[model samples]
Target: MNDLDIRCAAPSDIAAVLRFWREAAEGTSITDDHEGVARLISRDPEALLLAEQDGRITGTVIAGYDGWRCSAYRLAVHPDRRRQGIATALMDAAERRFLALGGRRIDAMVLESNERAHRTWGSAGYHREGHWRRWVKSVRP
Candidate 1:
């Protein structure tokens, strides 16, 4: 297992986890959706798994299960930790959880421009589902 431990994230992990979400990769801080994260964890602790190695979260994935659609969202690995099997391990753990939750179909929405991420998910057995045009309307106007 590459000496990495996958486990459920606890309330105490909020700080370090947020840091990794914020500062890990350049231009990758688009993942700093903290309020969204808090809601997801509060709703489904099993959906948010942490990869701990030597006392640090090297990776994380927010797995969400809905009645009709189940998804693994915002799957991320610390920039320096990329290509180290961390992402794969995280996805495996999340998929297993999704299945246990009685999810039949799992989906991942990757930014089309991110070739590496596209390749990773593709190799991990997720194919191109379809193209989506995402229009985000800010709540605070």
Candidate 2:
């Protein structure tokens, strides 16, 4: 919508953001809970971006940078808001943030089973790295 407001997540917004993810996001992360998200906002402050329309969150994306790498996670849009350029607006904001921070490239994590997300990422100019596979070891149980 034309009234969409894109901004950083505030401490007050954690609860609503968690709820929004549960409703709009495709998959869950181990750190999807309150404490984890709170920690992120505390540490990076501006890494979590939200798109709101009339005070309700319509989409979200986490544009994280660890000094060297620019990574994107949790790019999600509300079901009712799909095909409305919300995701594109979010990515455009995220990429601008990364570029402003001197980031050369951004890597996005997309679920292999999520075909819709694959299409979305591809449309955003992200390509799969078929030569590499992700390896993960949870530091916390």
Model 2, residue 137: what's the lDDT? 69
Off by over 4 Å in 2: none
lDDT at residue 98 of model 1 (Cα atoms): 81
lDDT scores in order: 0.78, 0.95
- The residue-level lDDT of candidate 1 at 91 comes to 92
Per candidate, the number of residue pairs that clash is 0, 0
Residue 15 lDDT, candidate 2, scale 0-100 = 98
Name the lDDT value of residue 11 in candidate 2.
93
Measure candidate 1: CA RMSD: 2.5
> Candidate 2: how many backbone clashes?
0
Q: Tens digit of lDDT per residue, candidate 1, span 1-141?
A: 667999987777877888887765223434356665676678887778889788888898878888677887767888888999999999988888888888899877677788888889989998885665656645642
lDDT of 2 at 8: 100
**Residue 19 of model 1: what lDDT?**
86
